[model samples]
Target chain A: MNLAAHLVMLPVLLPLVAAALMLPLGERRRPLKVMLNLASTLALVAVAVALAMRAGTGAVDVYRLGDWPAPFAIVLVADRLAALMLLATSVLAFCSLLFSLARWHRVGVHFHPLFQFLLMGLNGAFLTGDLFNLFVFFEVLLVASYGLALHGSGSRRVQAGMHYIAVNLAASLLFLLGVSLIYGVAGTLNMADLALRIPAIAPADRPLLEAGAALLGTAFLTKAAAWPLGFWLEDTYAAASAPVAALFAIMSKLGVYAIARVWLLLFGVAAGPSAGLGADWLLAAGIATLVFGMLGVLAAQEMARLAANSVLVSSGLLIAMIAVGNAEVIGAAFYYLVVSTFALGAFFLLVELADRGRSAAADILAVTREAFGEDEDEADDGEVGVAIPATMALLGLAFLACALLLAGLPPLAGFIGKFMLLDALFAALTPAAGLAPAVAWLLLALLLLSSFATLIAMSRAGLNRFWAPLEPRVPRVRIIEMVPVALLLAACAVLTVAAGPALDYAGAAARALIAPQDYVEGVLPPPATPEVAP
Target chain B: MELVLTIAIGVLTGSGIWLLLRPRTFQVIIGLSLLSYAVNLFIFAMGRLAVDVAPVLEDGTGNSDPLPQALVLTAIVIGFATTALFLVVLLANRGFSGTDHVDGREPPP
Candidate 1:
């Protein structure tokens, strides 16, 4: 097999194998564990790069499990969108791993294994071509995430973890229900097959199909933290460790990705005018989530909570953009997802630095009290926390990147994405399509208001933390902590510079996704009569 | 029979949601469990009601859909894992905070 074929599977298999390998290694061998993680991520990056190259050349790489034809057996597919997401996934995973190197000792046993398994699950979900496979991968990732979320075993972590697990498990049940109905009616688990078959089902059965679709959408929307279903996110993200929190950011987006894929493929034709809550419902929910998230951000007291709320706002924007359904808007959604993930990942890393800084300062204060025996006043006098000026500056830079990304400031990738989406919405507003015009205007207004709210919230955080003077002394920032934050921030800078190519590629990917007949044909040869579920 | 069962599931869901809104952690867990049961049954119903038919395919005979059965198996396992994880987390929170409240911190003075 060519390298592209290997690329399709390596992202998932490498991590699965690495996780198994790590399990046998002694817990004391931290260096070996780190090496395995780094190696696996590097391998994934290489595969992602190779896949991107192939996709750029306009080739869709499909891997048939057990060498069986489509609709008969499982398949893994890597298209332009999958490759782009794979690249983003690997980039975030690499940066998070780098951040965890120093913090792993704090996290203790099985962190390496669990992290690798989580990556395995994430990659599997992205690559799988079958709906059932997607469910399996989701479960795999959720299991690992449960352990990682509760890693520290603290009271707050536990409380948040319970909510997280409860919500996700409920979503999983809905997912199973939806898939079962889809399969019973459509008689296929293969996504490509379903796409081809679902449209041909009898009009009378369409309502039943819509119910299944709605159930699936509900589950995915809950996972994506959409309005009215996202109550668990703020507290859960706030309580998670910084590195683990960064991983969770991407996890939420996976649901959005799944929703986009299923809607554009299986339901787009069947969804027509008769389907009650198609893209419009998503757009409405997205706007509501955006407004709610911004409010949460403004209400937040802590830096971590603020960042968490910002994630919801960005996710809402992405979902709304996707709902527009125009090729250009979908392209913009892809670009926005990439930018948001990068910015949020960097923000989480900065949170870790700030946390360590506070912890170290506390330790220093304890030592000072011990040294000045019986003189509590002396120990407290003029001795403030140690603040590392350089670390603060780096964190400030990261904050700037995050602010620009979230607020849609110019010269950043977020600005370009939002501009493209708004342009598409404006173009869609034609007098002939009266409803479209009103919806387009509403979406644009919502986007603008959300951006303004984010700007205010972020500025408040920046002013309170960076502009204000710290206590007399603050702990020095460690190099180990600074490296990952700097690397992720640099990635954001590079993404900003490469916005043109990124948007262009996203446009092509979106076009391909929206019109998936090519993908369906590529997966399965046309049948004499396309099977339609009754 | 199916209508009655569906209504029962709906009642369970309503009760679960009510309990979920409570402030206590243990109550929330119980609520989640009740909700899960309701959800599982609801999912099973989506396959369409079958009294005597097995999900397995037989020669030239109608059988209930097997796909939902496979999905339910996966859901059951995942649900169990999540429930176990939740219980562990609840115990850990009780150990640390000396209270079984969902919000660990005391309200601002």
Candidate 2:
């Protein structure tokens, strides 16, 4: 009845209602659609901020839909970590939506409604206290994403959309099977109830439950773009339109977030044999993903693919740290998740605009045309600039900021994040742990080497685009496009300046997540937890 | 009855995975639909099969576990929407590239 009680559902409901309101409206009413989207996203941001502040106070806000009791009816929870994820999503969604207003909103039908629905789905996933709804929300977001990915009518976009759809459809199947397996075994889908039930599960059922969990992890890893299952990532992200690509950056982290929640809550120390069952797999997969991502980054011919590959590296680092199941490491990974997603999203938007003025055969076309005494190149509306244009200058600065953030350079949030993570892991790594020390060193080396590789790839890209423009032409960028990129980069700057509070928030959120009792108790009312034995 | 359902699911999944590895777009779509069927049935059976029983819960009367059924219904609708979208994308790509291959090339066929 109170505002805080209602606040738990506002984030999910706001977007759903707005999207529904926009659905019947014709695309010809573009201005109205844009206004509705911007207003809703801004409102969502405000609501998320309030929820996040409330969460920071260490109180878990749970709202049962229809006021039904937990473990039976659906509940939406806003714990510290969930609120943080919601806040990050709304922030990125706001910026990306603003950037799309430059022109992409009109490129396809139902863009506004789909965007809203995507937001609704994302918010619901983060807030839901049950696994069934998580699957439901994953489908919702993926369907919207499929629409967004193929928004512009291009053969390339459609090609990539097919692969994206196929892979996700398969992943969704896996998700369903996993959820069903868990439900069949545990007879419940509510996460808190599962936590209560897991400890008493029969030893005969343990392997089945673990199998279900592994299948679920596979689904998340596919979405997260882990090592072997991440083959579709670079091409799909590269093929997506700019703003859509930017928003898709957070899509990978959704996987990691789900893993963070489930691993800590349902399978933490309370789950007996299931405690930390798949932690080793997460570590191995994480390192392999990082290594493969490093190769992808270096081998990328286009800057767009490089941006995509770097996303894999970010996921790899987060997944590896998250696997260690340390409070401090999870906290550092949380901070790194926010920073790297921001940087990658900004870089995707920039690459789209910056790539406009260049032709496919840039160097060959320039030299051959000049040798043939043909000025056909200059006729393409781009003028060689004597002085750098403001657009290029702004783009260069944003790219530099993105590069620094991506490479974990100092005086930025990325550096601070990597430093925090290493500091935490260094304390855990020892020769006595046998395989862990080698993994620790490998992780540390990969972190630094990936950063170095990013520097090289990004500088090569930077030089190609800005520094030594082979054909220096001012890229036609509007104010709307530039504002979002600058705003996102400014956020990275603010994160750097506000690292103390940010780190404290992340630390508290991670502590809450690592200590599962707080979350389990928060969602469920005080009652007898029935113990079952086979 | 459980044995029959389990074998059916296994056969569907094995064949579905086999077809998923093919490079043709239509074949891949078929594989996906097949997999979706398997998963939907799997979700349905999560409720523990109740033949000739009312699905709705009534006072003291036996009913099937309806949650998995609800989830499967949602998955079915979503699966339909995606199948249509994939078909559209595939057609558009075929028109543009003059190929049915998933990668948009005929591969020397």
Candidate 3:
């Protein structure tokens, strides 16, 4: 009845309604659709901010659709982690919308509506408290993504989009299989109810439930782009139009978020026999993904492919730390998730602007020269003073910021995030734990090595694009395009400045996740009054 | 009856996965469709197979579980949409690349 009660559903409903409203308008009404889309996204941001503030106060707000009771009817829960994810998504969506307005919005039909639909799906995915509902939302977002990926259609985009679509379709089937198995065994799809039921499940049924969870996890990890399953990500993200790719930076994280939410809630210590289920597989998979991503980053020549590979590194790091199952480390992982997501989105946007100056053959030539060990024909003129245009300077600074953030270089939010994670990893070590300490050390080494690899790859890309050209031809970047990149980088700067509060929020969110009681109780409250059938 | 359904699912899934790995786009699409059919049946069985029973629990006489039916319906609709979308994308890929191979090019003979 009150505004607080309604706040939980607004994020999901706002975009759906906005998208529906935009669908009826004709192509001639592009400006109107854009205006509607922008206004809706801004309002979603406002709602997300309010939700986060409310959740920061440590109150779990649950909105039951049609006022149905929990465990039977659908409910949307807004706890700290959900609110944090919603806030991050809304801000990223707003920026991507702004970036697309410059030219991408006109490149194809129904771009604005599809964007809104994607937002709706993403918000719904984050907010839903039901597993089947989660599957529905995954389908929702994936369908919208399929459209967006193929937008501004080109030969390469179509080729990549086909693989992306086929792979995801298979993943979706796996998702359905997993959900049905869990439902068949647990007899419930509501996450809170499953937490209550899993501990009491028969020992014979336990394996089925775990199998279901593994299948579900596989579906999510495929989206997260882990190791062998992640091969599609590089080509797909590389070939996608810039703004769509930027928006997709969060989509990969969506998989990690789902795992964190569902895995922790259902299989936490509260589940007795089922406690710590699948943690080992997660760790092994995460390590493999990190190593593979490191190799991918080192091998990449194109800026977009490089950024996509770096996304794999971030995802692998998060998934591995999450498997470590320490609240402190999980908290640090959340911090890293936020920072890396923002950095990756900015880098994807910047790739378009920074890449426009050079001919398409530049990157390939650089690679070939490296392979052949060719010396530069031009003599090095140290300290050649060339007047740089203001636009080029701004673009270069943003690119530098992205590079620093992705590579975890010092004096930026990325460095702070890695430091916090490493610190938490060290703090979590114990004598009685046999293999954890070894895993901690391995992860520590991988983190630093991946950062170094990203630095090398990014520097090679930066030199080729910005520094390699003797007479730098500045790309014609519009104000609309530049502002979004600046806004994202500025967010990273702000994150760096306010590290204490950000880390504190992440800690609280992680603690809530590690202890599922709060979420379970929040979703399934004691019956206030017995329902009277009319 | 359960064994028959299980075997059917297993066979469908096996064939689907095989076709999914093939080089041709059309075969891949058929593979996906077969896979979805298998999944739809699998989900349906998750509700526990019942014959000639009302899905709704009116008088509670041999009522089948209704939830998986609903879930399967949603999955079916989504599977249909994605198949159509994949078809369109495959056609577009063919239009651009001038090949039916999933990789967008033919292998040398």
Candidate 4:
């Protein structure tokens, strides 16, 4: 076996081993835990980058556990789509861990190990080429997230964590049912093999397969936080500690990635009538989700809640794009995914530090003043301490950058991502068989409306927090905390500056996703000649 | 035998769903446990229930598919772990909020 074939497993293995190593170390060994986690995260990032470069060349790498063959054994495949997700996740993880190191890690026991375990689960979910393993990984990540969500042990965190746990547990049950149905119908848990077997399935079994697929879609949508199924998301994410919330921004996208990969690969244009069967419902639910999120963003009383709503909007757009089933939209959606997730992740990290020094009364005061009209009393509370202009200015600037990214304003990657998506929508209309012009126009309008809503909400919140400046005690944000936020925002800046190559990579990934022939081949190669000469 | 399994799964899932809809956190956790049991059994039945047969292939006639059994085992273990974790979180939540209401408040008592 090629040594590089082993690289396919590194993303999952690196985090798992590091987390295991950290488990036995006492909480007193904080420095060692941080160092190990940082190293593990950084190494995973390097591996993901390498994998992305390799996948860009259109090669799919597959690793078989214990040298087992694909169909009957565990397989992990790294295609362009998987590699891209891994890269994005590790980048977010590295920043989140760095930010947590500032003070949040000390508030809770086992924060570091749980974070690493979450990464392991994420990487495993991204890489595993089988359905059963996907369930295992989903549970792994959820369990880790449950621990992290309750890290601070506040009423709100625990309450929200309980809701998050309960909802996901239900989804897990649905996941099992879905998996069992698929297995019963196809007798295979390997995704690629199932894809091959699905079309040949007896017509009588088609309904069961469809039911299973629909149930599976429900599970993913619940995680993706689509409306009706996503009531748990905004509050749960908002209540999490800053770094944990930041880490969770990417967690939501795991569902987006899974849906796109599985729906396209198994029930793609290749599946005949089922080819695009779910597209319309996806579009409907996505739009509803977007509208619901916009309302939440507008109504959110706190910055954390607003950020959580924006995460919903981001996922809604990606889900809508996936439902479009066009390579063009998928490409733009992939780009959008990277930019928005980073922006939202950064915003989540920034929320705690930004809110720390401000009086909760002042926050309400800021809101009411805006509602009633800016008046002299808006600056009611006189300062008792010297305000740090430089730190306040730095946070304001960071907030502005995140706002621009979230609201799809000019010159940032968010704008570029939205532009690409709009461009794709319009470009699709040029072709006769593309999404109908009216539907395209409607989607275009909806996207614009969501962005506009985000801008309005963010503008009010940003001004209220930074500009109002009344009753402000300068938040004693640490250099460690500030550094991670800056790094995350800088990463977004890099995405904006590097949009050309980024778009190309996303395009390649989208194309590969739309046409997963190579992926299927990599996962399920013709079984090697019966080695034992049976 | 298959009909019996079907009815068992139906009862478990129906009861689970009913419990899941309740506003109490403890009930929801129990709902999840019951639902997982239903799912585990469903996964087991997917391989086609068999009597007096080995899971592993021993002769030309073959045996029940063991893959579903294996999958169900893993699922059961995971379900156990999550239930324990959920119970911990619920305890913490009740400690903080002073109620087991799913919304974290008492019901006008």
Candidate 5:
């Protein structure tokens, strides 16, 4: 009934409506396409701001569709964590949209429409209250991504896109299988209903539930680019356009978010042996992913490929933190998600700036000159252009933020997040817990090492481009591209400046996730009978 | 009986993985499809292999687990769509790259 409640639905609906409207607008009408894209993204930002403001008041806003009671009907719920993620996503979406504006004409048919649809799916995924609906939203997003990933029809993009699509589709099937198993055991589709129903199920049925949970987790983990299942991410991210690549970076995190949400809600309270096994399994998998991803990032050569690999490492660390299930780690994970999203988003934009021209000779010369300052004659004769000085300045700042953030350096959001997660991991360590301590220590070491590796790789790439010599002439920095990079850089600055409130909010969000009885009660009324017929 | 079926599905999954690792795009597709069939059956079996009982509430007696059934239905539809999408991508890849290799590239000189 309140304005905040009304704002909850707009993030998803605005994009859905925009996508529909853009379908009728011919692709050749470039101005109209740009207008629609900007308008919709701006509207999402407004809605995200409102949601954040409302969340600050200390209560989640739940909207049930068709005004039906929670268990029987669909619901859209927004807690502080959901609100914060939506805000981060909107920031990335806005920047990517601005970056794509100038190139809209060149991107060919349905680019704008697919973009809008992708946002619709993202917003829906963040907002949906039912497990089944999450799958639908994921499908919606992936279908759109398939188009965006292969937009240019180049062999590399097409090949990478096929692998991406294949792996994702398999994961989706696994996800559905998991859901069916859960439904069979719990008899409810609504998350709120399932939360209450799940804990009450018999012990004999618990293994099925655990298996279902693991299957579901596997599906999401694959999407999150967790190790062993994430072979497709590096190639896919490397091949896509910068704007699309930036969007893809945020999209992959959706899976991590889902896993965190589901685990805390369902298994966080499961008693006895089940809890021990569930927690241990998650911790093991999370640590393995962290180590594998970090090794990959350290070994990567291509700039785009390195950034892509870094995403896996960061997500893996977050998952490991989530496995600890301490409130502090949850808070840290939330903050880390925001910082990583912005940093990676900016990195993709920077990669676009460097690779704008198609000539290999120009690229090599530009890199050479940028790495070492030289007079025009001394610069590579093949060098055709250079990055604008102002753009280079922004790129420099972007790289610095990325290094500090991803490396978990002091005074940045990433540092604070990592510190909190490590503190939680330390507290969780015990002699009785046996392997957990070893795992925790390994995770901590791998996280630190990975962050350092990301720092070095990015610095090398950044140094080669921004700090090196002047080519005879530099490629002009396009205004459209600069807008996204500037906005993301601004976001990182805000994160650094407002670390206290952000961490506090994240901590509160984490607590809310750990004990979601309120969410359950808010969505579903107390059962009519203490026990329902099985 | 159910255990045997589960083992059979596991074998199917194993074979699918082997094929998926092969270099050809067509083999990869076939591998994925095989894996999907195995996975779907495995998922359905997790509901504990109910027979002669529908999940729908009936005659005030017993109903099989409704949740897994609902989940499997959606999974089936989504799986079908994904398979179709993969097939289309395969066709497009062959057309664009003039090869059906999974990597769509010639081995290095």
Candidate 6:
């Protein structure tokens, strides 16, 4: 009943209420709606930070709705992992909303409300202790994203939006089927309770449970943008407006977060036969996704598509590391997740600005030149003497920072994260439940190869866009739009400077995730004595 | 009852997936609807089929499980909303692309 207990619900409630309030205000009061949206997001950040600090002290905060007791009632648990994800979500939401203030919010009807609802769903998914609740939250977020994806309503946007909707609707059905299957087998939908019951489940029902879990994993992987399941990602993201794409960069991570949480908590070392049920398959899928994403990055001509591919690369790395099932490696993966997501968001915003400086024919011309083996320097010889404007220079620097981050280059958080991740992967070389030495070496090489590929592709695109422009036109960059990019990049810089503490926090979260006894106990307390009516 | 339910789910899913792969937006939307219906029925059957029994417990011996019913209700509501949204988007897509093909263009004759 105290304030800290209620804080667990605020992240979900604040957005829901704000979105409801904004819906009734109508389109005429755009400025007021923007202010309300900004205020709500900023407040969410504050709450998330506070929860992170509280969770850092190694406490699990649980809030039961309507004063209902544990397993039967829906509960929200804010442990280190949930709090960390909430913090990341709020930071990205705040930045994306700020960027939208430039122009995107006015692009279509109900933009502000949809944005808030998306946040609500994301926070709910991160915090919910019940599997069924997770499905509902997934639906909420997907619906909002469907709206936001088609906000500008160009032909390309509408086409991509239709595909996105169809794919996700199917995924939602799979989610329901999986949840029901698990419920039928385990007779409970609460995750913590299921974790307790899974170990003692009848052997005859094991296959059914595993099948259900596989279905569930498929649903999450689709949303997470795993290879073959995520062909819709690039088109949908590339076609979306800048702010929406920036916001979506975090949405992909939501799947990884769920996988790490559920897989580690429910199928960990405690489950006798199911301890490592699908680990190898997860590892295989992750590697394939990583390779697919590398090719995508190299082949992409548009800047937005390049950013989208980088998201896939990051997701692949995280998914593979999570499959390693070592607490330490998972910790480093969390660091990588946070840094890469921020960088991707900033990069998406930067893409719009960078592409704005070029003429409409620039992309086609570049392709034609490449196809014909024409010298690009000779084509722009007439405009060679034009000086780069200050705005262009700033964008170039931010672009350079993003390139470094995406490719895992040094002197930024990306390098530190990748280094820590590699170090942890090598350090965790136990024969059982850890990476083999050869596999570790292979992962190292693969990581390096992917990073190298990203570097090459990014430099190629950078040169084609920034240096080989047919004309040096300065985009009318708004201060509001520019600051969000700056802020997100600054966050990456801060992460680099504070790598020691950040990794420690991530390590704690990973440990808490691997051994969720506190989480389970926190949610399902010893039955409280019933009050006698006097 | 169980056999009938299982066959229905199987047929619906098979047809839904087939329609899902069709070329037109309208077919895809209908496919999605059929898939959702199959999933809803599957979830409802998870509680185990019972005949003429109260969902809520009166004496608790012959009562059907209430939780799956509740879950199915929520799923149906969400599925309805999404199907409506998909139809709207389908119309908009047709209007914008001037074609009903999922790819926004017709195939060669």
Query: Which candidate achieves the best DockQ against the true structure?
Result: 3
- Candidate 2 overall Cα lDDT vs. reference? 0.85
Off by over 4 Å in 2: A360-389, A430-435, A528-534, B56-62
Clashes of each: 6, 0, 0, 0, 16, 0
Model 6 Cα lDDT, one tens digit per residue, B1-109:
8899999999999999999999999899888889988998999998989999998778756799999999999999999999999999999889877999999999999
TM-score of predicted chain B versus true chain B for each candidate: 0.89, 0.91, 0.96, 0.95, 0.86, 0.95
Candidate 2 per-residue lDDT over residues A1-534, each given as its tens digit? 477679889888898989999998986677788899999999999999999999889889888998877877899999988888888889899999988876556556788998999898889999999998998899889989988887765667778888888898899889989999999899899998888888888889888888898999999999999989889888889888788899999999999999899888888867887898799999999989988888888899988899999999999989998898878778988999999988898999998878867785244224334433444334522232222358888889888989999999998888999898888778668554333777788878888898998889899999988999889987777777788888888888898999989989998998888777877887776663544233
lDDT to native, each model: 0.78, 0.85, 0.88, 0.87, 0.77, 0.88
Q: Which segments of model 3 are wrong by more than 4 Å?
A: A361-389, A432-435, A527-534
Alpha carbon RMSD to native, model 6: 6.4
How do the residues B1-109 of candidate 1 rate in per-residue lDDT, one tens digit apiece? 8889889899989988888778887888788788878877766776777888889988877899766677677677767777777788778777767877777656666
DockQ of each: 0.54, 0.85, 0.95, 0.91, 0.51, 0.91
RMSD per prediction, one decimal? 5.3, 4.9, 6.6, 6.0, 5.9, 6.4
Give the Å error, residue B2, model 3: 1.0
Residue ranges of candidate 6 with Cα displaced over 4 Å: A361-389, A430-433, A526-534
Tens-digit lDDT track for model 4 on A419-506?
Answer: 9999989888886646877778888998999999999999999888899866666786667778888888898899999999989989
Provide the TM-score of the second chain in candidate 3: 0.96
TM-score of 4: 0.94
Winner on TM-score (1 vs 3): 3
Ranking by lDDT: 6, 3, 4, 2, 1, 5
Can you tell me which runs of candidate 5 are displaced by over 4 Å? A1-4, A270-273, A357-389, A422-439, A469-473, A527-534, B1-22, B34-73, B106-109
TM-score of 5: 0.87
Note the residue pairs that clash in candidate 4: none
**Native contact fraction (fnat) of model 4:** 0.98
User: How accurate locally is residue A472 in candidate 2, as Cα lDDT from 0 to 100?
Assistant: 93
